[model samples]
Target: MVTVQEQGDTVVFTVEGWHKLWAMRSELRIPRTHILGARRDPEASKAWGIRAPGTHIPGLLKAGTFYFDNTGDNKPTFLDVQHRENTVVIDLADEEYNRLIIEVADPDEVVALFGPAAAT
Candidate 1:
């Protein structure tokens, strides 16, 4: 699992426990302005992007960095996901990454931080 925290103009994602070992990533920070939006879909499936410089186990886990180009949101994406349900999907601007697929404890609270207008 990961914890989401806001520090000044940046939002930080810190992976915890063994997940860190699996993801090969411990922390990530992005500016709030680069956030496209945040959403929680309990029915959301696994990461649908190409696994590049990352880890995956079909329907099990998708941990590491990925890339998506065909969908237009093409960029280096970071994912540290364990569960398929109630996943927090944070869409990012064209900065370092285009998307973040991760699992958090509270999806609703995390999405709220992005606000409604963040998507547009």
Candidate 2:
């Protein structure tokens, strides 16, 4: 699981517990301008294509960096989701990770933070 918090003009995503090792990251900070939007998209966590440096256990957990395709330009995605129901997808631009799919306690609350235009 991951925790989201807003600090000034940046949004912070802190990886919790063992997810840190799987995701190979302790935290990610993105400028507010880089955030495209966010949405509740549990299904997005399904069928993750290829994991370069991450962990995936079929119906269990998915944490780390993943690529949807082999194409070189395919930006990677960071995920830390165990239960699909609690997943929220955050889209970004001009960042290392193209997207973030994580399990949060309250998906609705998180989505609301990005506003209605954030649904993607």
Per-candidate local distance difference test: 0.76, 0.86
Tell me how many clashing residue pairs each candidate has: 1, 0
Window of ten residues with lowest summed lDDT in model 1: 41-50
lDDT of 2 by residue, 55-120 (tens): 999989999999887325689988999989999988888999888888998999988887543544
Candidate 2 weakest lDDT stretch, 10 residues: 111-120
What stretches of model 1 exceed 4 Å from their correct place? Answer: 42-45, 116-120
TM-score between model 1 and native: 0.84
Residues 1-117, candidate 1: write the lDDT tens digits. 889998999888899898888778889888888888888754443536777777788878878888765446557778877776758778787577777778888888888988543
Pairs that collide, model 1: 42-86
Per-prediction TM-score:
0.84, 0.91
Model 2 stretches astray by more than 4 angstroms: 70-73, 117-120
